[model samples]
Target: MSRTVAMVIMGAFTLYFLIPIWWLLVAGSKDTGSILTTNPLWFADFQLFQNIGDLFAYRDGVYLEWLRNSVLYAGVGGAVATLLAGMCGYALAKYRFRGREMIFNVVLGGVLVPATALALPLFLIFSEVQLTNTFWAVFLPSIVSPFGVYLTRIFAASSVSDELLEAARLDGAGEVRTFFTVSIRLMAPALITVFLFQFVTIWNNFFLPLIMLRDESLFPVTYGLYAWNTQLNQLPELRSLVLIGALVSIVPLIVAFLSLQRFWRSGLAAGAVK
Candidate 1:
């Protein structure tokens, strides 16, 4: 009876989460007129393709530019962040160095600090250096992931054995070669987790870009959609475009999660064993 109740509750939560996506699909498929007139949860016309085309073609393909910018920021930033976090975490886990606990504690503190809280300060610092409105402003900050560091540290400490490192060193492998060749393979699941988390965080980040970038070409898809959304009164036609853009924006995230789901599962199982 308890198990059945839990299943029913889980199903309810799933539907609750999926209902908005269903509405976005249905609403994005309709023209502006149909969207306001028809049922929001059901398709009125098959205008999804047309809406997508319009979204891409609008403003001389500015939406595509935004998407490209998002890809650059998220993809590169996530990869670099994962690499840096992995190295830092691995060192903290495996090496015996003075002030290691202090550094780890600081990283833990960083994990506790909210990103939004840091945004204004980061903006001020960037402005001081005259780096605001540049790609580096957003990209630099995105690459610093405290949670990623924390997670990687925990995973590395648990999964990577000290004996393995000693064996690699005994085989005449230097620290750099040992890390790249041996440790990285052992920490693949944690690294992937860090990459995905950072990727999604950078992809969906809005406030940082909102403060850092003035160039429309530099805006990520999230801010671009917001820019369109804010102009709904002036250009009511943009309403449909915003809906379609939002719908399209989430596609990459879904694809990334789907592709990397196996890694996540394996990471979980490894954690359970460790």
Candidate 2:
């Protein structure tokens, strides 16, 4: 009876999460006519391809431009953030410098501060620098991830060995050489984690883009989809396009996670072995 009850609960939770995705799949397959006439949860005519075609053709493929901007922002920002985090983390873990603890504490505090809380100040700062309504306005802010720094520090301390650094020093490896060759390899899993986290965060970020950018062409998919959603009142055809666009936007994220999941698993195994 207990086992049966547990299965029932698991099934219920699974359906809770999957139902919306299922609806999108079904809805994307329906044409405008079938969408009104047929059951929303069930498949109508397979217009998924047609919807995709229309999505690209909408407003001269503005959605595609939004997707490109999102990819550039997330990809570049995440990479830069991860690199900065890895360097800072390695320095904190391996070196004993003046005010090291203070710097770490500051990063910790930054991690605790919500991004939304900083949005206004960031916007003002960017505006002051004449960066508002620009890609750098959003990308610059996304790259300075305090949480990524913290995670990298923890992972570096655990994953890397001080003895290895000492040996590298004895072998005439410069600080930079030691970092790239020895420390970075050990910190791969952590770097990957930081990259994935920052990537998804930047990709999904809406409030910052919304506040910083007024140009629709510069908007990321998050804000672009939101714009479409709001226009649904005037343009009912946008409903299906928005749905398909949302579904399309999720694909790259899924691919990124799947591609990086191996590192996470390997990291876990290495930790367990240690």
Candidate 3:
């Protein structure tokens, strides 16, 4: 009975998340006029490819531009954030130095602080420095993931061995070399976890980018979809486009998760065995 209940609960949770995407898939395949009237979970006209073509053709292929911007912001920013977090976390885990605990505590505190609260302050600071409303405005903030640092620190503490560092040093590997080679190998799962979280966070981020960027060209998919959404009443046809864009926007995230699922599963399995 307990196992049955657990399976039911799991199925319910799965459906809860899947239902919205399912609706989008079905809706994207329908025409603008049919979207509101037709079954949201079933295809009507089978216009998915046609709709995709229109979406790409709209505004001289602006959707593709938004896609590129999103890749740049999330992909590049997440990679840099993960690298920095891994290095910082490794240092915090392996080295004993003055103010190490204090610095670690500060990073943990940063994790607890809401990112939204920093938006206004960041805006004002950027404004003062003449950096607002530019690529740096959004890209700069996307790379600071305190939670990534915290998680990486914890993982580094357990996953990496101090004896290995000593052995590497004796073998004439410098600190940077040792970290890039030995430390990163052992902490691969943790770094991948950090990159995934940071990537998704940047990809889905709305408020900070919305606050910083006044130009549509720099807007990521989240903000771009929002802009389209706001004008849906003016252009009812935009509603279908927005839904399709929303569905398409999620594809990259799905791809990333699917591509990394093996590593993620192995990480979980390793943790369980340990």
Q: Estimated TM-score per prediction?
A: 0.97, 0.92, 0.96
Model 1, 1-274: lDDT tens per residue? 9999999999999999999999999989999989899888899888999899988898899999999999999999999999999999989888899999999999999999999999999999999999999999999999898877787788889888889989999999999999999999989998898899899999999999999999988999999999989999999999999998999999999999999989977875665565
Backbone clashes (count) for model 3? 0
Query: Lowest summed lDDT over 10 consecutive residues: which window, candidate 1?
Result: 265-274
State the weakest 10-residue window (summed lDDT) of model 3: 265-274
In order of TM-score, best first, we have 1, 3, 2
- Candidate 2 lDDT tens digits, 1-274: 9999999999999999889888888888777667668898999778898899999998899999999999999999999999999999889988899999999999999999999999999999998999999989999988898877787777788888889899999999999999999999988987887888899999999999989999888999999999989987898888889888988998899899899999867754553454
- In model 2, what are the clashing residue pairs, if there are any? none
Best candidate per TM-score, number? Answer: 1
Clashes of each: 0, 0, 0
Q: Flag clash pairs in model 1.
A: none
lDDT, candidate 2, residue 229?
Answer: 91
What TM-score does structure 2 among the candidates reach? 0.92
> Per-residue alpha-carbon lDDT of model 3 for 173-251, expressed as tens digits?
9999999999999989878878888999999989999889989888898999999999988999898889889989999
Clashes of 2: 0
Model 3 C-alpha RMSD to native: 1.5
lDDT of each: 0.92, 0.89, 0.90
Least accurate stretch of 10 residues (summed lDDT) in model 2?
265-274
